[model samples]
Target: MRIAVTGSSGLIGSALVRSLLRDRHEVVRLVRRPSRAEDEVEWDPKRQYVDAAGLAGCDAVVHLAGAGVGDHRWTEAYKKEIRDSRVLGTAAVAEAVASLGTPPRVLLCGSAIGYYGDTGERAIDESAPPGDGFLADVCQEWEAAAAPAVEAGIRTVHARTGLVVSQKGGAWGRLFPVFKLGLGGRLGSGRQYWSFISLADQVAALRHILVTEELTGPVNLTAPEPVTNREVTAVMGKVLHRPTLMTVPPPALRVALGEFAQDALSSQRVIPRKLLDSGFAFEHPTVEDAVRAALRP
Candidate 1:
């Protein structure tokens, strides 16, 4: 299949690109700068422009370009950056594909489990309605931005991703070194449930969604079983052979992360109902399994 992918340099995107290439699938990388290679296409999400000709004849488009939510302290400006990056970038990709004479068969727009904000211990799935919070609002807008492609009769799927369990990047990337140094511990009361998936499963799920014709709406990319922050701490310590003796208080987290701390400490017990129902299998099904996969060379 010929797939055009944005955010090809990101944690999940990079891995997905590698997997697709390994399978001999042609990949066109959408970059913000000038196209430097035959597989490169220039796009400007800020202006909502994509080189339609570059997208022509592609079988699918995986739009994943967005600002890192945890990359900075949540100042009001940085929050806006997060929202604009996802919403605008998705709109650009959607519009471009819709304008193509023959639109891509599938449009997988990146989303997050944050859409079901602070679900506490209650496990949720794709059937759940949008929750309340900054991220939930942003996710709704982000997914809606892909309407152009959907309205054009294209198969649009919103991949509501979870906390990726990989040392290569994302929140887990920062946790590995801290845990290895024996500074790892639970955050706050450590009771918040964290829905997570291994990097390998994440990429595979994206590809599954791309090929699964019946999947057209929101599909979670999380594991079947979700673990709490305390459980994750234990697994990290056990897998890394480190001591989990420290505890980060909620107050300290608030001071350290600002508004983002609320999200960090939020509990979301999400399940991959759609993925499982669609016959997608997870390479790492448990927190321990994910930690071990992340430790692989």
Candidate 2:
């Protein structure tokens, strides 16, 4: 299959690209800079520009380009950046793909579990309605931006992802260092649920979606088992053989993370109902297994 992917340099995107290539699939990387290689396609999502010719004849497109939600403190400007990056980027890719004479069979647009807002103790699947908050609004718009592809009869799938657990990058990446140094602890009350997937499973599930014709609409990319923040901290401590006694108080989290602190403290017990129903299996089904897989050399 000829697969075109945006955000190819990002943690999840890079991992998915590597997995696709290893499986002998042709991969095209969408970049903001001038095309530097045969596989590179220039695109300017903010300006709603994409090189449609470069994407001609592509079999699939995985739009993963977006600003990192946890990369910076949530200033008003940064919040806008987060929303624009996802919405504008998705719209550009969707439009470009739809314009192709023979449009791709599948368009796997990126979504997030944040769409559910705070799930609290309630476990949710794709059947659940949208929740409230900043991320939820962004996700709603982000998914809606892919209307062009869906309207064109493309098999559009929204991979609503969760907190990806990896030692290499993402929120999990930052956690490994702090925990290794014995500075690891829970944030706020540590009672909030955290839905996480190992990097390996995240890539695998994405590949599964690319070919599963029956699967469309919003499908979560989280693991089957969701654990609380306290549970995750305990697993991290056990895996690292470090003490996890420290705790970041609510006031401290708000002071350091700004509005983003609410998201960090929010509980989301998300489940990958559609993925499993589609015959996908997880290599790391448990929190301990995921932690071990991520930390393994």
- Writing each residue's lDDT as its tens digit, candidate 1 over 151-235 gives 9999999999999998889999999999999999999999999999999999989998998999988999999999999999999
TM-score of each: 0.99, 0.99
Highest lDDT scorer: 1
Q: Clashing residue pairs in candidate 1, if any?
A: none
Candidate 2, residue 159: how far the Cα is off, in Å? 0.7
Off by over 4 Å in 2: none
Candidate 2 clashes: the total is 0
Query: All candidates: CA RMSD in angstroms?
Result: 0.6, 0.7
lDDT of each: 0.95, 0.94
* Residue 115 Cα positional deviation in candidate 2, in Å, after optimal superposition: 0.1
lDDT of 2: 0.94
